[model samples]
Target chain A: MFSQRKFYTPYTSPTDPCPPIEVKSYETPPQLYLGFQPPCLPQYASAKEALHRGTLWPALYSPYESPYKRGDTGE
Target chain B: MWYYEKKLQYPVRVRECNPRLAKFLIEQYGGADGELAAALRYLNQRYSIPDKVIGLLTDIGTEEFAHLEMIATMVYKLTKDATPEQMKEAGLGAHYVNHDNALFYENASGTPWTASYIQAKGDPIADIYEDIAAEEKARATYQWIINMSDDPELNDGLKYLREREVVHSQRFREAAEILKEERGKKVFF
Candidate 1:
């Protein structure tokens, strides 16, 4: 299975003014994993849940977690 | 032809007054890859696109309008009771001077939206590619907006919009392949 969130390390300078950002991360959309949507793909159980999730199909759903909250940022 | 919806596609709840946050949100509300641009671009291109993908464009284009309304509601609630000082501090001084808390079709930087931000290339492949890129860019903008905002309630709506971008992008990609498979195929007029 492909990971939705990805991380990488950035180069740091000896005399850098700000604290070095050791790790940086970003999200990959679900479409990157699936070549093309197929018919009869599994869907959310209820329309209300699908509406809240913003997609009817769970395979296509990709949740975004803020890097700031994830501690992936220098802040 | 469209029917009016009295409610927003997603609920927009702004629990606190934050003019500064509202200022940042104006980017999506009127920015190049914002909901309005997305809506206009897809709807305008639908007429010239292939019949197979026309309904996709129509449905997504219509949904973009609903997203636009949600952004408008969030901005409204965020700045409804903001003081002049708060507006100034929020970096909306020029906006207040001109629109006085009214929503303008301009970006966060105060540059008004222009048709140059979008394209209606008659080529179906080119247009569909543009639509896919637009979805990705909108998704990125939503992420940045979510980063800037700290209000959980507001983030809920932003997250929904961002997820919708992913869904739309997937649909557009599927449409592109659907168009691709039509290569060398003919339709009787």
Candidate 2:
């Protein structure tokens, strides 16, 4: 003797609501500290002229000389 | 006026994105001591400055406009595909909750725009000093934002911004020196 059994599969709709999503929170790390040197003064004869004309100022000008003076010597 | 044209001092290329970092950079656009304020302050102040200092201020002021564009672009790219959920996750609470997908013009903390950020007193000496302080403040803010972001792409942009602040500060200092020299030569009663 043999026995037969019936089974049905339920249909899932294509437009069914999405299942709740579980998202893992991401932590933003603290920003790192870094030091930046100031911008370098452009070294050019014309820039030196501009310095003399008060149009440019070299970052490392000697305190003794007016920015306009032109000499390698600090004085 | 005879017209002359000049090209961009630096190339403006499309940069990579990290949406979270972009939101903070937006402060430079409309925030206190931001590029918009810097540009307006210099340009407006130039009017009352002596002829000697006016050109320098004008040139620098114009450059600030370019910087404003750069910041805005960085923000746009960062936020391009940002979903509301991601925005909220990124701690851009105000942007997500209030503006939806719209990018309203606001400061870093999402405050509305104001003219109080700019000051253009007629005195040239006063103006130049103000310019120096403004540049330093902007540099500091850039540093603070750069600290907050971990994205290298964002960091690159921030570094460039910070460098520009340094350069502008030096230029303004030079301008101040020029003003002081002129005042020194003036005959006083």
Taking all chains together, each candidate's TM-score versus the true structure is 0.95, 0.65
Candidate 2 regions with alpha-carbon error over 4 angstroms: A1-75, B1-17, B182-189
True contacts kept of each: 0.79, 0.00
Best candidate per lDDT, number? 1
What is candidate 1's lDDT per residue for B1-189, written digit by digit as tens?
999989999999997999899888988889899999999999999999989999999999999999999999999999989988899999999999998999988888989998999999899999999999999999999999998888999999999999999989988999999999956588889
Each model's DockQ score:
0.79, 0.02
Which runs of model 1 end up more than 4 angstroms from their true locations?
A72-75, B182-189
Task: Give candidate 1's error at residue A25 in angstroms.
Answer: 1.4
Docking class of 2: incorrect
Q: What is the lDDT of residue B29 in candidate 2?
A: 85
